[model samples]
Target: MEIGSFDAADASLKFGAAAEEAALNTNVVVVGSLERLRDAKDCHKLQRVLEASPDKMQLITSVARAMSAKKDGASARELYLLPEPVETDERSGSVRRVCLIALPSACSRHNSPARPHALTSCLKGNAGPGSLTVVAMLDDPSLAFATGCAIVRAFPTWVAQSSTAAKMQSKKINVIFDAPDNEAIPEAEIAVLSWAARAIRFTARLVDVPCNILNTTEFVNQARVVHALLQSTLQARGEEANAVSLEVITGEDLAAQGFGGLYGVGKAAAHPPALAILKYYPPGTSAADQATIMVGKGIVYDTGGLSLKGKTGMPGMKKDMGGAGGLLGTFRAAVGAGVPKKPLYCLLCLAENAIGPLATRPDDVHTFYSGLTVEINNTDAEGRLVLSDGLAFAA
Candidate 1:
């Protein structure tokens, strides 16, 4: 999956004014707030940007108006098939699909203007072997980053497919941010959005992959890649002094270092557990500066240890490491954008809570890095144990 952007000049050259050339085999999705789509002026400007035919424009506007009349304040979306099929290259065939997504007027206090959940829902399963262009109508330029993040979340990278199908799944995704009145988004913002999309997809892919493929060892290896990239980036900018450093304490070493919480939970797993730490020091002034530390619970898979989860509860346990994945992605993005001014530390408490003879029992007692002794009550409550070890190490 690729998430990219096109400037006004580039878009005009590729898509043309009326999408005559690009619309043939491409899937196009137009997304915006319901209130904006209801306004005649705003909707007309968007139509001109997409170069939609008069009939298609009418269909889109009518749908938006009807949705607005519901007065229920629920988000709505609709897909329209093009009347004519557009031809593609000799290899792939033609396809004609268009989706219009409208966000609700009502928003919770924390979520305004854009609702990521609604947007992701609208984009799910829209992928194919062809190209997809998303025209996001935004009231503010900064929303473009959020839009990119949401778009990537809808298309996760992990999938179980045959080699032939996997080869055919590679698709092109382009995002065009059209502000109010069809205003052009800046080039710098577009670049940032692209990077953000990449990071988001990276995180989502980690969460989507199964435990067999992405175990504790694999997670540590992935973090090492990010660490190396950050180091290289800092070196390229002539700020080698700010190079990132990584430390890994695994298996028996964790137990030896008093990380009993982490070692206890993962001792029974095939792959030994680990505590991976990444440290980033700014270019200058570090010893006296206060550092910001982040801890992530990277439970590769949770089978509930001795207190096993039921069939219904164990299926989606692959996503237990979401916290670690998110932090790793964010750290990579932050460093890629620019070195931060403050010292930063990221700790990944990685483990797999598998039930076996070596697994922690309900009566087991363990001492954490903080020297606090905890009596095991429920082995299923493993996330807090790893998190406690990470926090103690950070302190």
Candidate 2:
């Protein structure tokens, strides 16, 4: 009946703060050729490990190789957490956990995909919930951004499982860029990454929530909540609240508008099928000329209708609305990034593809909103039906 209380603002604030603090306190260790490693500062722990292993290249290359020999057979990465915490600043007697990130010498020429794979693989397994991870800055901007995104993407696993746990678990991990003193990466850039991460997490959570809790009506209501948050943020900044608006069309309105595709697919459910549109029109922007429409499928729960799916397939039907979830997340992120000046529209075609006496069956032909007749050969293909209505309307 509800997706319950998931607050977006609270999540953004918490994640951003944690990431900033974590970046400041990171104990950085640089891995490269022996000449470079010896010249690198603040890598005392790494030096000790090299002393024991006696082979720097082997130590880096065999990070997962040696671990695979253990009984668990777990997938591992090149990042290793030193058993002994190293003194980050000897004068202040400050110490932090030293994590070694291996980068090849002359990394610019390196083109191995395993670099990011190793980074995310290790962090996903070892990093704690709501913890901050700091990696030494990569000279390549594209690589650094990709690594940051990977770090942010890993946080959602915990969020998806948090509801079923005994203690409310945190699924947010802040990944900060650990640049050298000479580097001047702005704080705003890091915050942008946090916003992007939260958006991704938000989308994943919406898709992961059970359909019973996120039915059509509830999904629309959730959109309203997000819109209201946007309105509030705009008002606080003395901007026009009407710049962003949400319009929801459902039930008789859908029928009156001749949305046969949406109606045919959703009429069987207790909650009526709906089309929710979130529109953003910045000042002085012509809605007709400067519009970009984003469409998402919002099948709250797909039971495959009369062409019912097997029990195994039904369990994962909750993710049928992933498109809508991702759209909404992207909407928020775009707004947060302050790039919504042009006219933008997000159309969510929402419905529950449930079975009932009213459900459209095989051999049924429905005239869609665009006046196109579609024969229902199999109700399992109903997602396309609803999406057709959305595309037609948006176009």
Candidate 3:
């Protein structure tokens, strides 16, 4: 899947202003907060792409107006299908469908505005293999990044078979941000949003893959790929020395280095366990500079070890590495946007808690990086073991 952006002028030319013919065979969906949809200027800019079909435009406007009149607790989203397929030029041989969606105004105490979640749900099946153009109306420019991230989440990139892979391989999603009062979003902000979307999709894909295909070794390889990409990017900017650096300690080396917690949990798996560390030292840093450290539990899969979980409880243990995946994505996104002013460290304590003859049984004792000993009571409690080593290393 690919995500690109369009400024207001570019959107006008590409969608409707420059030519009488609408974009051929495209699916256009416009999304906005309740306040933005009610604003005259925001609504006008959002509907600009539909100018060729005034009847369809009128239908969408009527629905929006009707929604505006409803009580505060009304449904968070409303989708309206165009009454007729948009006319197209002969060479294209297809017509277009337009959809309009309104996001919720209310936000819960524990959540940000409901717009991002609502938008993601509304876009799920709508973003198939064909071309899709999303016109998003934002009250604040920063929401553009959230909107992009949400859209990427709607289209995940994991499929089991080769035949189904094609369905997930290629998709084109174009986003145009229409700010309140028709203000233009800065080019720099758009670039950041694009990188964020890329990172989000990358992380989601890693989490979606099963442990059989994405074991401890494959996870390390994936981290290396991100490291290599970061190096290339820094090299292009003539700041190669500022790039993030990676280090891996695996197999017996983990035990030799006194990482008994990590080594013990993963010793039984077919693949050996590992601890991967990534460090970023900005230029001109000194000993006086404060450092930030993040540690993630990268259990490739958890079978609860000898104290095993029931079949119903173990179905999705492959997602045990979500913390690591999320941290990796955040690190990549932060570096891509710009180097941090402070020093940064990311520690991925990777292991697979598979049951085997070598597995840590109940009452087993293991020493951690902090020189502390812990007795294994419930083997399913392995996440804390790996995390303890990572935190001790960070300290």
TM-score leaderboard ranking:
3, 1, 2
Return whichever of 2 and 3 wins on lDDT.
3
Residue 307 of model 3, lDDT score? 89
> Clashes in model 2: which pairs?
none
Q: What's the lDDT for all of these models?
A: 0.72, 0.64, 0.72
1-395 per-residue lDDT for model 1 (tens digits): 21112122122222212332243334667777776565533454445445556766777667767765222233545555355334753333333455666765565778745677667875775444455666677767667777767866766545656453243235455665667765666665565555566677778778877888889998998988788777887787788834688999999999999999999999999999999998887777474689888899999999999988999999999999999999888887776666468888889999999988899999899999999999999999999999999998888
Estimate the TM-score of every prediction. 0.82, 0.76, 0.85
lDDT of 1: 0.72
Separately for all candidates shown, the number of backbone clashes (residues 3 or more apart, or on different chains) is 1, 0, 0
Q: Flag regions of model 2 displaced more than 4 Å.
A: 8-18, 22-121, 157-172, 179-182
1-395 per-residue lDDT for model 2 (tens digits): 34555563235323223554434232432322223233334333333322323344345444423332212111323343333334863233233333444433322235442255455555556553333434434443334445566555545532344454312333333344433333545556655665566677677768867876788988998899879977886677676888889999998789889999998899999999999999887667767775889999989888899999998888888899999989998887776655676888999999999999999999999999888998999999988999999999887
Per residue, candidate 3 scores C-alpha lDDT tens digits across 30-85 of 66765555452336554555443555556656666666522233233344343344
**Which lDDT value does model 1 have at 346?**
88
Clashing residue pairs found in predicted model 1: 24-86
Per-model C-alpha RMSD: 6.0, 6.5, 5.6
Please tell me which predicted candidate would have the highest TM-score against the true structure: 3
